[model samples]
Target: MAPQDEPATTDEGFVPLFDGSTLAGWHAAPRTFGSVWPGGPDLAGRADLAQADADARAYPARWEVVDGAIEGFQDPDHPGFGGYLVSDRTFGDFELRLEMRPDWPADTGVMLRRRRDTWHGLQVLVDHRKSGSIGGFFGNGLANFHAVPYVLDVSTGADGTPDGLVLEDPATTLEPMTPDKPARLVRRGDPEAFLAAWRFGDWNRLRVRCVGAKPRATTWVNDVLVAEIDLATLEAPNYDADAVAAFLGRSGHLALEVHDNDPRFGEARWARGARCRWRALEIKELSPGD
Candidate 1:
């Protein structure tokens, strides 16, 4: 069924992307990596957005609308079929704001500047597992950017490992890390202040800004600047820096990822992995001329 047509704009210059009632202007994509990327099976069978939206709406076990929020679930009876809900419209430079809360052990993220055929793009991770690496960049098939505290404590160290079991206090130093590139300790912002401001057990405000020309991306959690990365300068082995930089300039859709869990981990694990909720998604377009 086609979603009801509604005004997707507001007076505040923030466009309503989700409409809080329907999945209009959005297409459901299967898990971008294992099922849709390089050498992967094509799980995104149909090409139409309405069909994809219908499929997602029908299977509330995977994606559903609840009280104005987009929710993803991993029911024991329905597992492993995970993917992303991608916006049909493409955006260039923009400021996006949203609130998200993941269930315990669930993993999810907001992906931006994504290419159409594959999931090669940047993402802000909402990892709620014991990993304790929330609000980091997932990189998808591209690159991962993370900010870690510089201070000594139990939950973190200079090497990005848990030095102790207890976090006595917030660390003052926030550093950038690219574990996939084996890179670490790149200074970014005030980690301690970000931690002190982060509110657990509730919806966390996330804001992302992109330049798209030179391709500088910045992320904030609960209004605290946690990471800023220049895609043009990112050093990733086996990846073309020029191509990566060019890819960032391409306008693409905003996708909400429904993390795919390994089936080998069993249904219980899958159920835990697919739980997340998002709300208040709004975006303001910024032109180069502006």
Candidate 2:
């Protein structure tokens, strides 16, 4: 692995996505779009295209380069508005590596093979909030299938400030399995190993590898294998591999999300003034031979 401040060498076959000083190759996704639920409204249809484009141009989230890192937060002026910073290039099979440190209460993620026109894809969960789970798989538009290893809660210090995180049993934390909410295909990784590898309040390295049209995606947190999902064959309720492949295709842009602070939650989904910082973003496009 290369240092966080420098790009990987050619020998490593990884090219830098972030230039370390600017958002040169990135653009914002649409703002005001609702979370990509199973039966969510079609915000990208021709009927709404004009409005969606305008929202994208306005880009409600604040994304900027700070101290050699990409900092993303909900724009103060546009409270409750959040969006994604998407890469200009699209990739089919690739391994993405980046370092991220998100503040508590933020529901962020790395959207893989995300549609250029909307927030539809496979999401690697970075939900840094109450009862949230990291390194899980969330189907943004593929029937909302969630495959999480485990959920977690934050530990507070004496001053009532978040001090650390405590892993919780998925059996207790997750909602009961149902037709709309399925977890039977979840690949629950080692919780103790993940906890040991996780660095609280510090930047943690995340690596994701996606391959094939009906992709097999895997995630690692701080070098600890967190979760894996073979989308093509996983027997999860409401998931259709052929339909998903048709919807997303073999290639799409990668995106970094800054989630909305929904009013329904009452409490802010993202902490006020808090930003998630990302650095050392690089990707290695995979070939069939390799």
Candidate number of the best lDDT? 2
**Best model number under TM-score:** 2
Error of 2 at 33 (Å): 3.8
**lDDT per residue, candidate 2, 130-171, as tens digits?**
667789888887776788777777778999988877874456
User: What would the per-residue lDDT of candidate 1 be over residues 147-166, giving only the tens digit for each residue?
Assistant: 33322223556888433322
Candidate 1 to native Cα RMSD, angstroms: 8.0
- Clashing residue pairs found in predicted model 2: none
| Residue pair clashes in candidate 1 | 31-83, 150-173, 154-164
Cα miss at 212, model 2 (Å)?
Answer: 1.1
Per-prediction CA RMSD (Å): 8.0, 4.7
Candidate 2 ranges with C-alpha deviation above 4 Å: 1-10, 31-59, 169-186
Clash statistics: count for each candidate = 3, 0
After TM-score superposition, the amount by which residue 25's alpha carbon in candidate 2 deviates from its true location, in angstroms, is: 0.8
TM-score of 2: 0.85
